[model samples]
Structures are given as C-alpha cells and as structure tokens.
Target: MEKQILDFSLVPLGLCLLLAYHIWLLHRIIKHPTSTILGINGVNRQVWVRTMMEDVSKNGILAVQTLRNNIMASTVLASTAIMLSSVLSIIMANSKARPSEIVLGAESELGFWIKFLSILVCFLMAFLFNIQCIRYYSHASMLINVPVKKMSSSHLRAEYVKRTVNRGSCFWSLGLRAFYFSLPLFFWLFGPIPMFLCCVVLVFMLYFLDVTFDYGGVVDEEEEW
Candidate 1:
C-alpha cells in the first residue's frame, strides 16, 4: 500500500513540473523570438503587416481588408471556445454522468471531477482571451484605416497599429496555448501514466514545432494561409 501511494504521488508531481516547464519555455520563446520558429514567424508577421501599412494607398483598402481577415479568424476561435465551455459545464454539472470506460478506468469520483473542472477552466480562459483578442483586432482595424499624412504623426500612428496588432496576436496565442494544455488533461482521464507520457510527447512535439533552423542565411518568412 505504501509503495502504491508513493507511485501515485509521482503523477501529480510530474504534472506540476510539466506545466512549469511549459510556461518557462513559452516565456523564453516570447522574450527571444529569433530563437524559435513560431516566435520568429510572429516577428516576421508584424514586419510584413507594417510593410503593408506603409504601402497602403490613401484609401487604405488593403489594411482594412487585412484587418477584416484577422477579425474573422479571432471571431471563429472565440466562438468555438465559448461553445466548448458550455458543453463542459453541462457535463460537469450532471452528477448522473459516469466516466466512459474507454477514457477512464478506475478514477475516483473526486479526482475525476477535479480533472473535469480543470478542463472546463481551460476552455473558459480560452474564450475570454480570444474575446479580448477580437477586441484588440477590432480596435486596430479602425486605427489602421485612419487617414494620416506622411509625417512623424503618421509614423506614430503606424507604430500604434503595429503595437495593437502584436497585443492581439499575443492574446490569440495564449488562447491557443490553453487549448494545447487541455490535451494532456483529456488524456489524464485514461490514467496518470497515459497523462505523463502524453505530456512528455507534447513537450517534445512543441519544442520541434516551435524551434527554428536557419540554413545558408535564408529566412523563411512566408505566412501560410
């Protein structure tokens, strides 16, 4: 019995360490975007956006259209997060609902409920952050299309637009991160062992996906649609 307790204790400890490491990695990438693929892509995206703004004609049609696309994407993510949060809330409130045999084997009632609540919180946070992202995007849409002469004031306005867009992008990234974090929580339903393994795999996958490799002084700045 003592051995079982010791083994079980490792599960929560592992999970805590995994989460801490993930946060630290994200902070490092954001602080030094040149070191990672995703972060570098984010920097390149801002540069491209700034260039487009500079190239915009007096009518600013191109900037307006680009912001419209950003708004649409943020709207979709926000809507999805809201819907998932609602579904999770219903599932958590229903006491009669039992864990599925496929995902959950012998989890205690309290443990299962706690996991469900954690998942629910993730979706809720995603929803809130996405909504905030939409707000920033919407505000930037107006600012990006504002008429400005080619002067210092215009440069300041352009800088403001870039800052707003970057803030919105950060919020969008956070929302997506919440979604990613929830994946291992879902696997935790099966067992702590599965959850631990999934967390390890997730960290490795994220590292590869996020890290950048440069070759021959070539920088890939193409944004995928």
Candidate 2:
C-alpha cells in the first residue's frame, strides 16, 4: 500500500513538474527570444543561413557539409532511440504477467506495464522527432546549395531555407528533450522516490543550461533577429 501510494502520487507529481518547466520554457522562448539558449541559437542560425545564401557559389559546399553533419547526428540519435524502444518493447512482452515486490513502485502488474510504457513512449517520441529533424535538414541541404540567382528567380526564398534549418534544429532539440524526460522515467523503475528526486535535479540542471546569462558578452555584435 505504501509503495502504491508513492507510485500514484510521486509519479504524477514528477511528470507535472517536467511538463510545467517545458511550458515555462516555451513561454520564455516566445516572449524573450534572447533570454533562452534556444532563442539565442535560433537567432544565430538565421544569420548563418543568410550568410550562406548570400554567396551560394562560395559557401555552398560549406553549407552542405554543415547540414550533412547535422543529418548524421540526427540519424544516429534516431537509430538509437528506435533500437532502445524495440528492446524495451520486447522485454515488456516477454516478461511474466506476475506482479513482483522487487520493483520499488506499485506491486501490481498494471503499474509495471504503465512504467514500461511511459519509458517506451519517450523513446518512440525521440525517434520520431529525430526523423523529422533529418527530413528538414535534408531539405535545407538541397535548398542551401541552390545558386542565389536561381533561388531568387524561383518561388524558393532565403527565408524559407532559414526556416527549414531552424525547424530541423527545433526537432533536434525536442528529441533531446524526450531523452531528458526518459531519465526520470527510467528512475521510476527503481522507485517513485528516485524518480521524483531525479525530476527535481533534472529541472534545475535544465534551467541553468537552457537560460542564458552571458548573452550580452558573447553575442554583443550580432543584431537582434
């Protein structure tokens, strides 16, 4: 009964905490673009795209190479996520239906399935987001190589290319977030106490990493996007 109470209460509380942090982060990114790392990186990415598009003849190779690197990274992450998801599903499927007291959470079979399913969902989401990241990066790679004249002469615009690259990056960031979310879920298997503690620590760590305090010193010369 005590373990079940911990599972029911702490698990939901931890999940809510993670959700609230992301909601706040989205608000910060939207309201004050320079305040967060994502916003600041987005500004620089736009500048990079503009610079690359300005002289496609000179920077085309560099742009393609850079985007290729991003694509490879996303590919690796997507593959890892899917592989983990598959392995977890297999473990869940093969495991006996009997409820065991060894788990730190609820002793019920339903609780065991819920915990596994939550972690599996996180991995699946990471895979899907990384796949989307690869798709956008591939599109941007081709678009970035288009000569300046042809780019302007057609419906395709530099802004569109910039948006594509940013969208890919956005997906990449989301995939990473999904991985981050899995950390606490993984701890939930040990017990709800560890999961709750992990959530608190993860939130604090992410807050420091996501918000920028040195923006003025590092990007002083760059114009606001």
Name the best candidate (by TM-score): 2
The digit string of per-residue lDDT tens for model 1 on 1-225 reads 553463377567657766787787677564555666656656666676677676567437776777788778888988998899888877777767665532365456667677788888888888888888989988987777665663458767877777788788888888988888888788777667777787788878877876665622244443221
> Lowest-scoring 10 consecutive residues by lDDT in candidate 1?
216-225
lDDT of 2 at 172: 100
Q: How would you encode candidate 2's per-residue C-alpha lDDT over 87-195 as one tens digit per residue?
A: 9888777746454653454567777788889999999999999999999999999988876665445335877888899999999999999999999999998899999
**C-alpha TM-scores of all predictions:** 0.81, 0.91
Best by lDDT: 2
